[model samples]
Target: MKKENLRQTSEKVWGACALAVKAHALAKKGARLESHRDLWVYKNEIAREIGDWVKIVFKLADSMHKNFYENLTTREDVLKE
Candidate 1:
């Protein structure tokens, strides 16, 4: 059981890291958003209110990567994000 729990934890952490990487790729390749101002650039280029949430996803991915390394985030905290 302990081994299984460790495996699950490891998998979750890796998944979070992957998510962060993918988000970065999307921002860099899809929108070319490299800096904070670039976020606005993407938003303006799209001209859609819903595109704002794309920024949130990028931020959340970053937070998840940090939380994964620190091991300070709970499953509930991630779910809320």
Candidate 2:
């Protein structure tokens, strides 16, 4: 693989990992919020929103990975002469 392509792949992988970690942190926060009755309703709502956001983030990460693999597979076909 070309150096630029390798670099791009590495960046994408790192970005995905970072996003996953963020999602995990948000999930933990959401769970913590659920433990407090005074803030339960509001916090639960926020947690639900965070859950949705995490799903979207993971979907984006999945797309990035899929695109990276597709690009790798078709590198020769897709590259400019």
Candidate 3:
């Protein structure tokens, strides 16, 4: 793999990890807010936000892995700057 590709993959993995941590924290708070109606609404909003972030992280990870494998087979770097 090219150095650039490796660096990009590292950055993406780091970003995904950070997002996961944030989502986990939000989920914890959301769980805690389950009993209060007003707080539950806020918790639901936070849950939705966490879902969106998880989707983004999954997309990024999937794209990166797919491109990495494709590059391995085709020797063509697909992640353009």
- Taken over the whole model, the C-alpha lDDT of each candidate is 0.53, 0.46, 0.47
TM-score of 3: 0.33
Give stretches of model 1 more than 4 Å off.
1-50
Query: What's the lDDT for candidate 1?
Result: 0.53
Worst 10 residues of 2 by lDDT: 31-40
RMSD of each: 6.4, 10.1, 9.2
TM-score of each model, paired residue for residue:
0.42, 0.36, 0.33
**Sorted by lDDT, highest first, which candidate order results?**
1, 3, 2
lDDT (Cα, 0-100) at 18 in candidate 3: 44
Q: Write the residue-wise lDDT of candidate 1 on 1-81 in tens digits.
A: 244343346446546644544465487566344554454355444435446665566556556656646766666666666
True-structure RMSD for candidate 1:
6.4
Question: What is the Å distance of residue 12 in model 3 from its true position?
Answer: 7.1
Best by TM-score: 1
Candidate 1, pairs of clashing residues:
none
* lDDT (10s digit) by residue, model 2, range 1-81: 456574356346546544545445467654332222323243334447566664454444444455565554344422321
In candidate 3, what residue range of length 10 has the lowest lDDT sum?
72-81
The residue pairs in collision within model 2 are none
Q: Model 2, stretches more than 4 Å misplaced? A: 1-15, 22-49, 72-81
